[model samples]
Target: MIGLIGGMSWESSAEYYRILNQGIRERHGQTASARCLLWSFDFAEIEELQHRGDWVSLEALMIDAARRLEAGGAEVLLICTNTMHKMADAVQSAVGVPLLHIADATAEAVKTANITRVGLLGTAFTMEQDFYKGRLARHHGLDVIIPDAADRSTIHRIIYEELVAGQALPASRDAYRAIIARLVDDGAEAIILGCTEIMLLVRPEDSAVPLFDTTALHANAAISMALAD
Candidate 1:
């Protein structure tokens, strides 16, 4: 069975849960969905841990979550948050089950697309943080690009104040479009919507370059892992 460690902002977890269940049922017959366990955490604790960069504390939280899932009969673990994947190593070490790395899954998809340079759009912390960039560079060998400082701040603000709060504005889409255009102009062959909520803001129709949704790619990876013998 699959285990979902979610609710790091819950909004994205909703996407993960829905996509996983829906995708499963669509592939299988009626009444078939992923046999799964879910453990949701308090967003406040998660947010604080992220804000302070307290990975030790964060690791403890994820390890505890993984242990509980393991006891609940889950043979695989999905953290359900790309940003929190910063603690992927510690979490994997703590759990007996395989913890699928979201970034790696997306990177695999990115490699298949044959894009040499990819632009990333996500929370400011994620784009600016070395953890995400380092993983993409080290694991995928693809050139990673991000918005300039000004656009990064704008995108970050929109993610926190608008997307997280479930607000969608045309101005937000326009801002993202501008960023994508610049990335394309700068030689980015494709763009990765690093945040799950980002797919809500920008669509392929709005983009001149190819777009990658980390959430969808991660969901597909989880499905493949779950269905594997």
Candidate 2:
């Protein structure tokens, strides 16, 4: 069984829960859902820890969550937030169950999409951090391209103070489109919506460049692994 360590932003976690259960019901020929042990954390604490760069303390929180899930009989763990994945290695190492790397899963999807250079749009911390980018390059041989400072700030603000709070405006969509255009000019064959909430803003239809939704790709990977023997 899988344990979902969610609630980094309840909005995206809701998506994970829905998509995972829906994928299970659709593929397994049952009205039942996938067996999951969930541990949801407080948003305020998570946000505070993130903003202060208190990643070590943050890892401890997730480690405790993983231990709870382990005791509850989960074989694997999935962290629902992309930004919080900055501490993925530390959390994975502390936990008893195997932690699935969402970025790696998305990178695998990018491989199937056959895109060599892909634009990455996510929280400022994620874009700035080497954890996600290093994994994508080392594990998949893909070049990860990120937005410039201004565009990065714009996208980051839109995600935390806006999208994650459940507000989706058209202006936010346009901002992402502009970023995608810049990425294309920079030689990006496609854009990876590295932030789960990003798909709600910019979609493939809005951009001339191909847009890969990280949430969908990650969900598909989890489903595939869960269904496999």
Candidate 3:
């Protein structure tokens, strides 16, 4: 069974749920669905803690969520949102189940595409911090590129003010397109929609290079693990 630690806004978690079930049905039959558990959080509360830089409290919450999912019979776990992956280590340590890191899943997809230099778009913390990018560099040996400071702020604000609220504005899409073009010009071979919510605003047609949507890849990976012998 797969356990999803989600509701980092409920919007992206919904995507995870849909993708997981769709994958199972595709591989099995129309009647088939994923055997999974979900420990959803109130994103408002999580958002407050995140913006306040209260990771200590956030870490505790994540650990508790992971433990609950493990106790609920989740053989493998996924933290549905990319930013929450900041506490992946803590959550994994607190649970008996293996936590499938989103960055690892994304890195694998990028490598499979034979892309070495990739652009990343995500929340400010995810783009600027070492947790996600460091994993890609250290474990996967991939070159991760991010937008400039101004673009980073624009991406971050849109994620919080709009994307998380289930809003995907055209202006935001255009902004992302421009940023993506800049990254491509900077020698990025592919782009990683590092934030789960990013897929809502950006698509393959919007980019000059391949777009790796982490949410889909992560959910698909969970299905593969669940169906593995």
Per-model C-alpha RMSD: 1.4, 1.3, 0.7
Q: Any runs in candidate 2 off by more than 4 Å, and if so which?
A: none
lDDT of 3 by residue, 1-229 (tens): 8999999979999999999999999999999998889999999999999999999999999999888888888899999999999999988888777999999988998898898999999999999999999999999999999999999999999999999999999999999999999999999999999999999899899999999999999999888888893
lDDT of each: 0.86, 0.84, 0.93
Question: What overall lDDT, based on C-alpha atoms, would model 1 receive against the true structure?
Answer: 0.86
The sequence of per-residue lDDT tens digits that candidate 2 reaches over residues 52-89 is 98988998888888889888998878888788788888
Best by TM-score: 3
- Mind sharing the TM-score for model 1? 0.94
> Per TM-score, what order, best first?
3, 2, 1
Clashes of 3: 0
Would you list the clashing residue pairs of candidate 2? none
Write one digit per residue (lDDT tens) for candidate 1, span 1-229.
8898988767777888888899899999769887888999987887777778787898888889999999999988988777878788888987788998888988999889887699998887789998887799987898998999999999988877788767889999999899899988988999989887787678899888889998888888989998984
